[model samples]
Target: MRRPRAETRWAYVFLLPWLIGLVVFQAGPMVASLVLSFTDYDLIDSPRFAGLGNYAKMAQDPKVARAVGNTVLYTLSHVPLAIVLALALALVLNRVTGRAAGVFRTIFYLPSMTPYVAVGVLFLFLLNGQAGMVNQFLGLFGVQGPQWTTDPDWVLPGIVLMSLWNLGSTTIILFAALRNVPKELTEAAMIDGAGPWQRLRAVTLPMISSALFFVVIINTITSLQMFDQVYTMFFGNQIAQQSSGDAALFYVVYLFQQGFQFLHMGYASALAWLLFAVIAVITLVQVRVGRRLVYYEAEEHAG
Candidate 1:
């Protein structure tokens, strides 16, 4: 006990820099932002307390509603598709062996490592309506691809499709989870005359449920906060124009325009807080759901 306690004290000493950095950076900004949420302040002017006035304006702001709607739609379209695709790829890769599998894994993962700006630019070129690869391919079948980024109807779908390029990390995580699943348990299930689907449902899924939960939560949070790709592809050079119409105005993009462009700092702070509340609630709900569905081997061992 004495030795462990001494080691624990040493651990704290080693962790001091990180703990201090968190307080100075993350916690400090969060508290400042919360305080700013109640105050009306342009960057130049002194902050004046507005209480809940900024938050109250949210209900009346049609643009806020539009941005939120766009964000929700994007999140709904992207998250499930990404998860399903990643899992399917992982399952396929898990069945392969040796150098060929390694080559394929590296090939798939390279896209995720590519810079977001480069990916956005690549997608824009590929999805362009006139001379783009996608439209040209569609023309071969007597069809036409929509102007992906320009047309409001197709912009969200284009963004979602672009987002899939980075599913490599998710695939790698699920692949690791699949590998960690006990082969003995699978063999036992097979010996009991379980079919492929039955074995997957009974043994495979439950064992990897924790990893699935983790991926879902992470993807949910990421999808909700999406901004960079939308900006890079649509709004990067057009800050003054506020172009891209209703389809491209994601929640974070709107918040950026408010705080920086329009200089509505107070309202922007309120929007940030609202986003935080939404993320917190969704994460809490997911955790509660996960408790019922996620199988933790540590819990089994403890029991």
Candidate 2:
């Protein structure tokens, strides 16, 4: 069946604004960047056609390797911790109901709404070595804290801790997914003498596996793009030099330095496209594995 021409025209008319915005905002800049990636443009004069020079330079750049390693390490450290903590919060939130549930949910979510710059500053203060709040707390237990901001060994871990401060959104998402699980399934498992751990393993987790998968993918991308917190806390700070700034030199931050700080516009564009490709490939792999692991209610019904 086909819609009437007048109705179809109205639908397109309603979508016109968004379509125009996409062409102008998203597609246009992407095309321009793609063209720029093949040239040598330093934000002044004409873009010299350099062919594959930018990519070749990127391939041989040691900073690029360091940035990629730091990003991967951060992602590994943060993603699992975020997923576990978020799921734990979701489980706790799942046990509450009514007004109390809403209050707790709002409390858990507020941190995610905090400005990244402020969060970075707060974390820097808290994680400071000698007299900061975190070390001060640790000192109560007769432990001396490492210099998180000035020591290379602890700096990356400290940044990971900072990133975990904004897990409210992930918790809320997992909490919603947990809520959607049918109570009947868990009750049946309980009736069969399944313990709390057994029920969680057999029923709760499988039911929420899709949400876990989503959180993993989203966290991977977000971790890869971490910049504002790092820049706010480390970039230009003298302590960062002592801390081995390479440990915090994440991919997106390096790209920003190239494009804006050093004015390597063309090289930055190439790096941007390479990052895009890496993300796309990784997402594809996750989706491939997810097909085997994710339990879909619709698929069960269809089968």
Candidate 3:
């Protein structure tokens, strides 16, 4: 049953590049970062051993606390909304076929494919307080539009809206998952006099639950790491100082401020590790909870 020596050698040869890359690129930096997390390495000076000083400071840092709250708020606001909206769009798209379906799918995905920087800039113009297109359009309706990017009450909402603009990919994934559901099952449910809502609840939902679970998990992780949009749109403005108010001061933004702007590399490293741990725990919890609901077609097939 053993493989020939030549085949074993070929297998090793095929894996050699990946092994080398792992050691040199991934493994090396990961170990280095772990060590750096425990030291004061401000990029300009020699790294000094700090043991747990960075973590201790993080515990008392107001900015860290604010960032954590903002991140949680952003995730709560965006993740569920994105998933639901994407799934709904996907469900609608699933009923269509041929060129129309393709056209609609491409249209939905175009926003996601657009550069984040471009999206940020576009939103900045659209959401501008006085001269922006959105406010101007609202003015015609006799409704006064608040300052979206500038007003504290509206900044987070603006950020959430901007984030949802890129739900096209999620929509496509959900559409594919919906399409993969067996037509025979749906037909059988229909023959049983099941209504549209009943069929969706009993048949469609359970079948696509796994994909839904995956989309939620992915959205949670991505929302936590939101940076480019906030940075490009809001950073270096009066809003940055308004962290006490409606500022979208997310965790990664605070980490960036600590590492580069404030030159607190060791503290930033600790924050990074803490974020990693938090994400790991959340992901594990999601998987555990998801086990109760996720349905695998392969398992059904095997059963």
Candidate number achieving the greatest TM-score relative to the actual structure = 2
The residue pairs in collision within model 1 are none
Best by lDDT: 2
lDDT tens digits by residue: candidate 1, 21-68: 999999998898899999998888999999999999999999999999
Q: Rate the local accuracy (lDDT) of all candidates.
A: 0.90, 0.93, 0.88
Model 2's TM-score against the true structure: 0.97
lDDT by residue (204-293, candidate 3, tens digit) is 999999999999999999999999888878874554345425277889988998889988788888888899899999999999999887
Instruction: Arrange candidates by lDDT, descending.
Output: 2, 1, 3
- Candidate 3 segments exceeding 4 Å error: 1-4, 236-246
Candidate 2 Cα misplacement greater than 4 A, ranges: 1-3
Poorest 10 consecutive residues by lDDT, candidate 1: 236-245
Please report the TM-score between candidate 1 and the true structure.
0.92
lDDT of 2 at 236: 57
Which prediction has more favorable lDDT, 2 or 3?
A: 2
Of 1 and 2, the candidate ahead on TM-score is 2
Q: How many residue pairs clash in each candidate?
A: 0, 0, 0
